[model samples]
Target: MVYAPIHESLPGPISPSDRIESIDALRGVALLGVLAINLVTEFRVSIFQHFLPAALPASSLDRAVETVLMLAVDMKAFALFSLLFGVGLAIQFEHLAANSRRALLLFRRLLVLLIFGLIHLCLIWNGDILTAYAIAGLVVLPFLFGPRWLLLAGAAAFLGLYLTMQVWSPPGLFPSLASIQSNVEEANRVYATGNFGEVLAFRLREIALILPLHIYVFPRTLGLFLLGAFVWRSGVLQKPNHVLLFTAGAGCVGLGAAMILLRAGNAMAGTSFGVLATPAGTILLALGYGAIIIAIASSARGNALLGWAAPLGRMAFTNYLAQSVIFGWIFYGYGLGLFGHLGAAEALAIGLVVYVAQVIFSGWWLGRHRYGPVEWLWRTLMYGTPQPLLRAGLNDSGQRAA
Candidate 1:
């Protein structure tokens, strides 16, 4: 009897030519969801205090916008991003494992990513998720080759810690308005008028306060990575049977929506379960959204309609970092200083405009370049050799020239 590693036994990696470009499009969709939530939440206020009603707009339009964001996005967006990123990591490993010094290469890629994350968290925005993702990636490194059952079990065990925490209602783990009221007030004034040093200091303060929250969430993130890799090993993303996709999509939507609705009912009734209901609901809905996105993008008509986001997805890392830079300048004290100024509706509108610009720019840039600027940098560092960047390096078939 012979044993093969999970990746080797799986359907095997899809080649670039045979790649499902729609996955990139789906990533773009997830990115937009994240943008929508961030504009009204973190961009306007610190993630630490955004939960306070005093921190957000209170008008009817703002109310409506918040409702939509809460129901449709909020936690769902980042969940989807994590899942996609996990899949990307697994696929990359599959492609690299056959080559020389694969694990070392992955470590280099993650190290570079961690550096980028640290830069974003300290300099650009304190709400950065890249650092979390990079850390999660490091933890997930060995699990990429683990057995499929072990992957699922690891995800469950880690995620259960979060579920337990939410139900247990740990102090400081989940910030309350009372605890954050002063921080909110000080942050409002400081973030708007404070100098760069002042702003950095306040951000650092919040980082200390939020460290526990991050610690709690980190395990869930690591679990999601394993879940993503497990799903990738199943080969559903690249070579799906439509029936299975539809079944999973439909079931997930039904169950996830039910969980959310129950949570809402609990909120109305002032039950403790409402707050506890969010984590599982959001994760399930995100998974459902992923399945549906792949299903839609798999179709001919859906491809044409949704293809605009493909470039943005292809350049996800570049666009994500660029968004932090653009929005940070727009809202932070060092730039336009619009913190706590924009209404929720206006903030979301601005976010949409930025997203549109990204879509257009990504498409234009990819037409002439083989990789987005950051992707080029990442690959260059990963391989210790500068990878080709220009489309001119391509053969007539639009594939890279050997």
Candidate 2:
């Protein structure tokens, strides 16, 4: 849910002073789920094999963890992340002067994001979303100039189209289970034991194979982006009831599960119903989580309670990339090579540890610096100048000495 700004405008980067702490807190909260789900993908198992019969955990503990993740985290985290990406664009638009050239600035910003995404996708992580987001962001650029209703309608229409495709179960749109299984087998072997060059080559090959999937998921990601923008303009998120929204989200989750069960025991059901159901629940729960966090951030007392999360959210871009780097070291072949070794339970535990450390570090870093390291770099490149990186007591480029 979004609301009208209580403040004025800026051009390049959003200053720490201009931020809505509630949204920061929401991003922080969303990152936790995101990390959990990513860990499962990165450390425990490949998402390509998610529909395989072998995906069911062998142990009760891992099974329980998988169950919780399925209902709560999986698609929900990515959905929230995508929604926030859209929200950030809308906020940037609002911050511009009335006569501002929105397209050029947004283009530069997304170009930087696309570069970051490509590096992440090709050299660092195979499951990168930044490129997909930058691509979708580019597609939504023209809509920024449209009226509020158009944003909402585009969101609904795109999402409806995506859902229809899922339910329709178009042949060959989904990769065969055998093909996916072969890829997963090779991925596990390469990521767990191959050297740097070997892993890099394998990732390149995998990216080419998954290119079609990128197209398939675009509508869902774009719809969420548009929905986020609409809410920001309409102020629909300004005062939503947290409990009610969360309850509704939980119902959606249950509804999605029921949809999958309708075709349960069918081979590779994820290729069919699982894909159809997962995203519906994801969008709703993401909204619910956002509303809950916003409500907390709105109150003086509640804001104080969730204050720690604000810094975490503010540094989300940095932390997001950092997770890939750190976890790659822990799980990939060139480092600890623990890939495909941990159970769902252990991966979840490690994810929690990583998130806590990020929370603590983000608070400490933001106390002294104006932006996270990556964010500072992003702004510098986007605006074609060095942005300030320190506070009143520190002298830096773009700042006067205290």
Q: Quote each prediction's TM-score.
A: 0.90, 0.88
Q: Write candidate 1's Cα lDDT for 1-402 as tens digits.
A: 232233333222233354568788889999999888877888887665555655336689999998878987888888888888888888888878776777887887788999989998888788888888888899899888778888898889888887877767566565556667877788888888888899888888887666666787887788788888889888787786667787898788788888888887675245556665778888888988888888888888889989998889989999999988888888889889999888889888889999999999999998888778998887777767666678766542334444
Q: Highest TM-score, which number?
A: 1
- lDDT, model 2: 0.80
Off by over 4 Å in 2: 1-10, 237-278, 393-402
Residues 264-317, model 2: lDDT tens digits: 434446575566655665676677666666777767887899989999999999
The list of candidate 1 runs beyond 4 A from truth reads: 1-18, 53-56, 169-179, 267-275, 396-402
Tell me the RMSD of model 2 versus the true structure.
5.2
